[model samples]
Target: MKLTNINKTFGNKKVLKNINLDFPTGKTTVLVGPSGSGKSTLLRTLNLLVTPECGQYEFEKQKLDFAKKISNKEKIFLRQKTGMVFQDYNLFPTKTVLGNIIEGPTQVLKEDKTHAITTAQQLLQKVGLADYATAYPHELSGGQAQRVAIARALAMKPKYILLDEPTSALDPELELSVLKVLLQLAREKQSMAIVTHNMVFAKKIADKIIFVENGEILYDGSPTEFFDPNNPNQRIRNFISSMTLEDL
Candidate 1:
């Protein structure tokens, strides 16, 4: 996706400001920053979950105007091209894991129920939750629910997966489990834009790393350059210090 001249504001606060960026295909591009630094808002804009007040979103040669009126057809088309995994693990308490996974495919994509079940089972196994197919959201731990959330997103077969702090609520071990799955996906060249504060994981998985602060792109480069200990960017250095302490 190519973003140009993007801007978004809520009430008096500007969340994103004149952002110009590009996400290359088959790469893991990690977004990192302090809390409420507009990283999450930028990811949401890709899927149109949060529309920018003005911008040009170029995807697969199709350009959409965020500043103008968009048709329902256009929104649906964009949504079809991407999926998102939220930090809160948005799942249906009333639906079992299999039910949650199949909802999008059977209802939105109109896939056969039998086929959806087969796909869900495979995704469950991929996320190390094959036995939790019948478990409800409340019955699972934080990490398990997030895995189900990732499976649900994959079930859509989205061209890109936008992850928003998927393991923020997990303990160290649980966070590691989730991060391993993400790293594996990165190795397999899955297209994803992740919003995370996990510097260690970001350094390991990122093909490109972007740093956002105060509603603007502060830095965009490879992980090697972004995390260089001798880099003179004070803001980046401070943020990295905070993250390291938090991790400890």
Candidate 2:
């Protein structure tokens, strides 16, 4: 998928400016920056949760002109190809873990109930939550809930998974658990784009690192180059220093 010359605004404030990016298949792209830098908004655009006011989005050979109104069918089509995991788990309070995972497949995709259940079970096991099938969101720890959320996204069989601060709400120990599951996904070559502040985890998982600030991308390149201690970009150097100190 690719975005070309995309721009977005809320009220009078521009949130994303002239953005051009590409998310390669079976690779992980990590977006990092300080608060209010538009990383989350950029991630949302991938799932069509937030639409750009200008430019085009190309997915699977289909191109959408953002300047024109997008039909509901087009939005649905785009969304079906992408799964989004937010900072909060956003699970249904009344549904069990298994129910939550199968809802999309059974309802939206109209998959057979039995098959959806089978797939949900396998996904739960993949995320290390096989034993918690009957657990409710309220009954799980932060890490457990996030894992369930990931499983739910996977059950939809999306082409790409987009995560926004997946571990931001957890304590360090719980955060580590969630990060491990994400790392495992990266190893399996799942196509993913993540918005996060965790520099260490970003360094570990990112195939490409993009630094956005003030609604514009300042850097986009390989992780090795982006994370190099001697990186010449002063802005990146300062941002990394601040993030590292914040983590400490």
Candidate 3:
């Protein structure tokens, strides 16, 4: 996908500014920046969750004219094409793990219930939560719940997934479970855009790195170049220095 001259404002605050970005197919791009730096907002814009006030958004040769009304067909196409995994596990409280995973495919995609449930079971196993299929959201631990959420996103068989601080709410030890699932996704060559503060994890998995600050992209490069101490970008060096030893 290619975004050009993207701009977004929330009342008096300019959240995204003349931003231009790209998410290439079959690669993981990590978005790194301080809190309130518009990283998450930018991810939302890519998925069309938060529309930019003005921009030329193109994906698969389809463009969104934000200056004009976005039709329901266009909105649905974007949402279905890119699955989103939020920081919090957004599963339905009343649904079991199996129920949550198959909802989108069965309802939105009009998939056969038996086929969707079969696919859901396979996804659950892939996330290492096959036993949790009958469990409700409240019955699982934080890590388990997030894994289920990932499975839910996968059930749609989307072109790619966008993650917003996926492990931010998990405990240090519990983070490994979701991170392992993500690592497997990376190995599987699943295209993704991730917003994260975990520099160490980013180094391990990111194919491309994009650093945004003050609503603009300051740097975009390969993970190797982004982490190089000799990198001439002082802001990136300063940002790395600011992270906790644990974060690195």
Highest-scoring model, lDDT: 2
TM-scores, all models, native as reference: 0.96, 0.98, 0.97
TM-score of 1: 0.96
Regions more than 4 Å wrong, model 2: 246-248
Which stretch of 10 consecutive residues in model 2 shows the poorest summed lDDT?
239-248
Each model's lDDT: 0.92, 0.95, 0.92
lDDT of 2 by residue, 134-211 (tens): 999999999999999999999988999999999999999999999999999999999999999999999999999999
Question: How should the candidates be ordered by TM-score, best one leading?
Answer: 2, 3, 1
Per-residue error for 68 in candidate 1, Å, reads 1.1
RMSD, one per candidate, in order: 1.5, 1.2, 1.4
Candidate 3 minimal-lDDT segment of 10 residues: 239-248
Quote model 3's TM-score.
Answer: 0.97
Cα-based RMSD of candidate 3: 1.4
Best by TM-score: 2
Clashing residue pairs for model 3: none
Q: Quote the RMSD, in angstroms, for model 1.
A: 1.5
lDDT, model 2: 0.95
True lDDT of residue 148, candidate 1: 92
